[model samples]
Target chain A: MLYIICMVAGLLLSRALRLERIARPIGWAQTAVTLILIACMGYRLGSRPDFIHELSSMGLMSLLYCIVPSVFSIALVYVVTRFLLKEKKNGRNRDSW
Target chain B: MVILALIALLIGTLAGMLAPHSGMLAVLTNATDIYLVVLMALVGITIGFNEGIVDKLKRHTLHIIVVPTCIIVATILGGVVCSFISGYPMNISTAIAAGLGWYSLSGVTMTNLVGAQIGTITFMSSLMREIFSFMTIPFISRYMNYSSAIAPAAATSEDTTLGMMIKYTDAEHVVVSLLNGTIISAAVPFLIPLCLAVF
Candidate 1:
């Protein structure tokens, strides 16, 4: 709930203020925040010891389990968007669909 | 920017690997979401600034309808196929996650509603979908017009990728993509939970 509110607030505030022109600058700021957050996450993780053992225990199956759905989803999106929708338009050929 | 993201991912992964407590690792993992949101917000602002909402609406009305419609349809089909292929019981959250091509919200929601294992699978799969989208955008766009490419690009905005889409793709498409993506992204957090609860 709070997350949703923050997102909505940020979006509304940014729009209300006409912060679009300075988007790149804002982007940089957001990027900085993201970096810091990621760093904090990493620091927190590094401070723990048992995480390594658990991750190792999962091993190759973990990688496969994580990767398979992603591959399948992308393939599905591509095939459906391309062949099924028949909306495939390259740069050279602009067909009026 | 891509390099920076890769560095962050590496650092996060390393931290997760090194952490002793699962709770600490979870915090680190959640940080990725924070990073993603901030990046997406900036992407939205940049897109909004470059292409005013009114103009973007006028330009991409068709695309806005077409892309999400396609994605939703594709997601439903994909979920069914995934359920059958994986031999796992299908549910709404997994379907939506597969459809949205990102698990961050849907996976977590499913976990809360269903169980941790399913949630983990959804997250992994959705993460893969995001990575795949990032890699294939250029190749896919090569065969697509501005709108189709832009809509999904906007739909899947991340720190490293949205800027590339904007820089390389048509302005109208970028605007449409951003707007469309923002709508879907916003809905995901709420809708995923609702879907999980209801179904």
Candidate 2:
């Protein structure tokens, strides 16, 4: 997949070159690209012919599918991480995980 | 960025609703894929470059790795249970959950193995999973631990859904998401076929 390749390329780039001076710049570029990608995603969804048809129907079901499991999993992770793991070195404490 | 994405989706939906017809959705889809791939690379570079990431991983390995493992199991269970109650056969329901929110691949796989009707449902379900991530990341970040926010997107927590993760969480979570996605994505191939085999 192009997805894996691109990420591997990035890792390769990081290794083969210093890029030390431009690390921050590269970060900025990543931010910009991410913004553009999100917008483009919106564009594709908007362009779909069946967006509304599906939305009122399967969309709602899909939402239920996503919500229930996500809620259950998050709760599970919260309990496991908060109670099971020892506290971190940073003293941010219970406020942030 | 969540607001930005929301606005963009709104504008895009309006555009999609208004347009007479367009032949370019396919092209845009490919472009988005390429663009996202690039973003993934950039994210990888950041991770590859960050020496501290390993240390962070050592500290948070349990959190980073185990969270997704738990989520994968929970999601599959939810899918199997819901589909069974709704009348689908056991294998089909399990296969659908095995999708892990990578809708297109899962949908097509189901279509090839099952049929259009269930395939479409699986596709819609997975697609909604991704869409739901966009809508929920901001809220998830607010209400839950940043990493727990990765749950809904599931496999896409590493890919297309990643921008929202970066927006709501941080680059650090972004890296963790890549790991999370990799693990879930790897599970998909084995899980889908294994479920389908039961059919």
Candidate 3:
């Protein structure tokens, strides 16, 4: 709920103000923030005891757990959007909305 | 962007391993929640800057839901297959899949509820999902429809993977990615427990 509210507030605010001039800056900030978050995630994971040991031991199992679900998700989403939503097979859909 | 993210992750991991007790590392790690919230708002602002996105949003109100639903169902089905192949209990397999790329929460939750081994699997698998999404979003955007790019991302699409969505896809798909992530993220906690109990 908080996330939704913040996003809606941002959307409304940006729509009201002419924010185009700062788009580049915003993109750069996004990149910085994203890297920071990823770094933090890495820290959390790496700081855990036996992190490497666990990864080496359960690597195959974990990989299976990750790969199968992602594959299924990608396949299903593609099929549905392709056939059900009837989206074009173009390379990208910048104006898809 | 992807290369930079990988480098950031590597540096952070090395820092963490070397100085696990560093006050600075702890503060930055703990502040991630705040950072995520800000990122979401920024995502909204980015979308808003795209002309006519709101109107486009309205036109596809009903259709926008298709992405997340497919992801949830497919993930569960994949879990079922993993159960057969890996010989783990269906309940545990599905519960792990229910993490939906939110590794931290799922890891802690499973650690508390289940045993450490299962928890580790949950954490590692979900973490891999996130890392894989980071790598695959570009290819998915190129080979499939823009909306399909959000599939691999699952719950991370809202914040962590939004960068990929913004760069590889367009504003409209970013909206879908955000909505899909929020819905799945909301479902993850309940879904994990529900799968454990019911299946």
Candidate 3 off by > 4 Å: A1-55, A91-97, B1-59
- TM-score of every prediction relative to native: 0.62, 0.59, 0.65
How many residue pairs clash (N, CA or C atoms closer than 3 angstroms) in each of the candidate models, in the order given?
5, 0, 0
Q: Return the lDDT, model 1, position B188.
A: 63
* Tens-place lDDT digits, model 3, residues B1-199: 5467658767877887899999977987778658766765775677677676566557667546778889999999999999998899999999988899977557655655675567657867988899999999888888887877899899899878998899988766777777778678767767888899999
Give the C-alpha miss distance for residue B9 in model 1, angstroms: 4.5
- Ten contiguous residues minimizing lDDT sum, candidate 1 chain B: B151-160
lDDT of 1 at B167: 64
List, residue by residue over B77-177, the lDDT tens digit for candidate 1: 55555555555555553344442644444544444455444544454455555665676667666765444444333246533356657766655555556
Candidate 1, TM-score vs. the true structure?
Answer: 0.62
lDDT of 1 at B82: 51
Q: List, residue by residue over A7-88, the lDDT tens digit for candidate 1.
A: 6666676778888667767867866765555444444434445545544433332344334443443455455545644545
Q: Is the docking of candidate 2 incorrect, acceptable, medium or high quality?
A: acceptable
For model 1, state the Cα shift of residue B122 in Å.
Answer: 5.5
In angstroms, the error of model 3 at B175 is 0.8
- Residue lDDT tens for model 2, B51-103: 56567677557667777878877876776676755567778777877777876
Please write out the lDDT profile of model 3 over residues A1-97, one tens digit for every residue.
4556766777777788877779888878767876777677667667878878866767798899999999999999889888766775543343433
Best-first order by DockQ: 3, 2, 1
Q: What TM-score does each prediction get for chain A alone?
A: 0.70, 0.54, 0.64
